[model samples]
Target: MYARISSDVEGSGLEVTRQLEDCRKLANSLGWSVAEEYVDNDMSAYSGKRRPAYERMLADLRDGERDAVIVYHVDRLTRRPIELEQFLEALDAAKVRQVRFVVGDTDLSTGDGLMVVRILAAMAANESATKSRRVKRKMEQNAAASLPHGGYVRAFSYAEDKVTVIESEAVVIRQFAERFLAGESLRSLAAWLEDNEVATVAGKPWRTTTLRAVLASGRIAGLREHQGVIVGPAVWPAIISEEQHRRIRALMQQKAVSGRRAPRRYALSGLLRCGKCGHPLYSAARQTTRRYVCVSGPDHGGCGRLTVVAAPVEELIAKAVLYRLDTSELADALAGRTAQDEALAEVTEQLAGDRAQLEELATAYADRAITMRANG
Candidate 1:
């Protein structure tokens, strides 16, 4: 007998045990020996979740381990019409002459029985769809009211109410934003969080993927998102400023673009820009020689192809970096800072700050307070 319930059936008083008892009684009356039973507890068949017991039972029937299948009801077996068709096919292939039910004795081996089963399955599927639509409508209404999702937000960074930020986690969130915007790599940040004994909302150590998700989230910036798209501003206070969020997004996009390009096989892939076409030069190795090539041809973008040996380019870059580290005053201050802070500074230097910074710089340049020669 196959008996399944999608929830705490005993607590809900669904009587799965009673269903099994009835099936056994029915088997006794028919003069058939009761075989093994299949049960799936707290598993929704209509939700399309895997029902291991149901699958195993089907396999057993196909392998001739069982000649007959019994269930409490047809809906208990399946709510999907497509699955009902599959079962019919499997039953025919297995040549199972009988399908018994506790509540009803239907000879399922006939064409008329199959049609009746299909119609029952269709009705079950319709009921499931109607339930799903109602649930979705309720959720939509809740979202429109800016209510906490699913009646409980339970986010790490936010209070149970969802609108109020938890100060401790909120502080960590701001630090995450600042560190990321400053240029700390996701993997490095994840490792640092682990080293500092910072646990995720689930009380697990941080991962690069998880850290990236947090950084990418607009919820920290007081924005509401539905299905991955930002719907509007959220009711909660933003942990990070809008400028910080914008800078983080831009940085993420830049990283994504670089990631989409070929993996850097050599060290000097990003240090050079094409003098001729202004495209970033990439490292390409040919036999023993690693060369930096500006691939901005007609095939790539459009540019005058520029190529240079990697050895000299790398040497120049190394010397410049070493010189800055050894001689620059800023480098001395960086040495005093944490690895995370140093990394952030590097990113800030690359990005030259946010849009407001650029606008301010432009204004200063126009006012002659910052000369183009000095700034460059």
Candidate 2:
């Protein structure tokens, strides 16, 4: 069986392991060999691009690699209509059968089988499209009312394991912004926090990951992000003002360009451009000071609307493009998933302790060797 569980199920019950188990059992019961498995991690079902595993699997079916392709569910294969059709056509051309959870043991190679499979695929596609429309409508409502639907805001505890606001974490985030706006470099902030022995949101000495995370966050500015889009009207109290949030974002934009270090520092150099003329808008420092400018109209003098303030635009861009990968449990069986994940928390705890002990022993041996060398 050519089995696939989209990246949405990476850590969930539909993980490759679970899907393999179910498919292996089903295939074995039917006296068939589970020849291969294909997995697409961190790839969204909504998009047709960048899914190598999905494409390869379709090609394999076309080349007669397997008599049937099995999945934990239909949506695990695809949610996009065009891509799904491409898959079905590949199957039809090859005259290969397919199986999914809903169609437990049915064959899809024969004419009758093909009709049933088509109906089910259509139903799955319709349901997926309907759900997609519903989600888009909800987000539109969010945008209209200025609510957070796209993961724009992140409280210290809110986005991580702790979904609720912890007062201490909020305080830490507020101080992070305060230090950021006071013209402290992220490196300096990290160093000072470490020297003074200040803890991060995760309660340890400062590091770049922990520092930049706070500075880039909009939670301090009373906004929230859902699925990479900015949403406001958070359920928790905010740590900083929307205006302060804008300033921090501006500072990030400035620092991203004008800092005196290695020279080639441009993120949106080739990606973003005028939606009208399709020219590029490069990121560069402002004056001798640190700031970036969007040079859309200067190239051709088309419209003045191409200019965006360095900071806020960068912040929005950062939130939008960075990672944007939350394929959250779309392939996992939602009904029985929570219990499986909850059971693994204890193992994570044990692994963390082992990691800490190993670090301490390594640190001690290095310190002892350095002292010996110095004394000698």
Candidate 3:
């Protein structure tokens, strides 16, 4: 059986347990067996939030662990028409013939039943759209009134009310901006935080990415941000001056522009992969020496897999490329080039696939399609 309740509805005393109880009663009355129970609490179907238990249940059905699904209602199963289509496809492929609901029944064995199911699904989708519009309008109204947005967690520098700054946290945020503008690198700032036993808002060890995010956030300057841009001054007191905020932002922009100028510095850039975790090796400098280190940072899913001297690695690759080019005999050139081409093709395909999957995982993580634990 499947059950879900959005956070808003959940606040009004509606519980997933009630739905599960009703669904179980219906299943028992029909003499149906439930292979598994899928419950998604505080998840919004309208917002396209990922439902891990629901997805797991669908996978179980697709794998023939179960040939039928029982939910409290069709809407409880899904509100997205696209997801409904995918669910129908999975059921068809698995040869599942029945879908039983506590409030209603949908027959998949007949054309008319399928048509009726589609109509119900369309209504659910419409309801979801309507709900989304209402939520967005309410949020806009709140924004206009300078009211704090409802969130499970407050901003790093702010208290639960989103207006009062945590003094200690606010001090750290100010230090981040001031120190960054004073020519301290993000790595240096991160190291300083770690050395001082300063933990992040999440109570994790400070990292370069974490420091950068804190330094770049407009919220730290007591400015409201919605969808990436700062809207206006927030209700809370600013930790740093507006001038300091502007300077820090400009410094970040300057570094970004310099980075874009030499996006690829080394000849073998993007060619090297970690031997351990199989992630891409990024070019980095350690004082005077340049090395290709695994791109994985504390937050980037890397485990410090591999690090190699950049000069030697690039020289070896260059020599090999030159050797193939300098070959005089057509037969020798063709023989060497053919093997090189095949190796290159294989690596290219593998890299492409790996990059695509990583990118998808990143997007899903950003969209809350996957949880922090699941992403890891």
Candidate 4:
């Protein structure tokens, strides 16, 4: 007996149970002794997903372990025409052609019955395709309306409704954004989240990839994204400002282009260049002694003619840095940096005002309060 239900949304397995009962009754009435039953609940035949029980039944049929097959319906046996053909081939190889269906009373013993099964399978496949198209269209419409996509778990900083911001998680999200923008590495931020007992929506420990995704998502900036494109503002309130989100994205792109590396083991790892070729010297070790050497190869593109003892060079650079920090020129540079910081703050505020004005113009145009030309 082979019983399968395409979808068991409630996961009750009642449909599969009902199918097996009907199939068993049909087999008993036909006076056919059943050796075993194959059941595939919550599995779809048209989706091309693996159905373990169905495959086992086919294996048994081909091995001649089963002389006959019984199912609740033809569609239950298979919705795909190709799979129906494979089933027939399996029966032919075993030289056992007895097959029965409780609902459609389909029999593989006759040529007409085979044709009917093929037609039913084709119809089922068409119906599945239509349903898939309808569902995808609905989802696209929902995305255009800035509605939340369906998911089992809520978004990181949002509630189950997907619109309401969870204050606690939102706070953490802001902290993540701020720290990341301040030049903290994703790995460091992930460790901070783990150390602070902050778990993801799925109750899993923080990872760099997961942290990077949340930081880069437009959802936190009150934007609706569909198929990896930001369509418009989302229904939910923004966690951090759009400006911060844009900066995070830009920084992430820059990091991706340049490629990030693990923390430097030595202070002067990449700071010193070769005197001969001016190429960056890589840190290397010989026995217990560490040194910086210019490597020659397609990979390094260096002259490989210069080498420096790591200890002396590192110590000299450290002393120089410390001495330079106490100089009047350094004091003057610090003062200049303070002024630059203030100027940057003013520019940032002005940019925010401009962004707000642009948003108002967009809103006016959308609401038909102003013409597109006037909004522009």
Query: Which candidate's TM-score is highest?
Result: 3
- Lowest summed lDDT window (length 10), candidate 1: 367-376
Against the true structure, candidate 3 reaches a TM-score of 0.38
Over the stretch 192-271, how does candidate 3's per-residue lDDT look in tens digits? 77778887767778766557667777777878777566789888888988788778777866766454332233433344
What overall lDDT goes with each candidate model?
0.62, 0.51, 0.64, 0.67
Error of 4 at 106 (Å): 2.6
Model 2 alpha-carbon drift over 4 Å, by segment? 6-13, 95-105, 136-376
Model 2 agreement with the true structure over 10-84: per-residue lDDT tens digits:
122245665566667666766777677777663454444576777788878888876777775455666543455
* Residues 1-376, model 4: lDDT tens digits: 9987775111123377666876787788789999999988635544578888989999988888999899865667775656878988988989987887664454567644565466445444444434444468779998998887865788898999999999999999999899999999987788777778888899988766667778888899998887456789989999999999889887876775454432223434444779999876877878888889997643345799998888888667656655654676434432323224556435334433433333332232222211111111
| Per-prediction TM-score to the true structure, in the order listed | 0.35, 0.32, 0.38, 0.35
lDDT of 1 by residue, 97-205 (tens): 8797653245676544554455444444444434444467789999899886765426768877888888998888888788887778877777677778888777777
Query: Whole-model lDDT for model 1 versus the true structure?
Result: 0.62
Candidate with the greatest lDDT versus the true structure: 4
lDDT of candidate model 2 versus the reference: 0.51
lDDT of 4: 0.67
Candidate 1 displacement at residue 297 in angstroms? 89
What does candidate 1 score in Cα RMSD to the true structure?
27.1
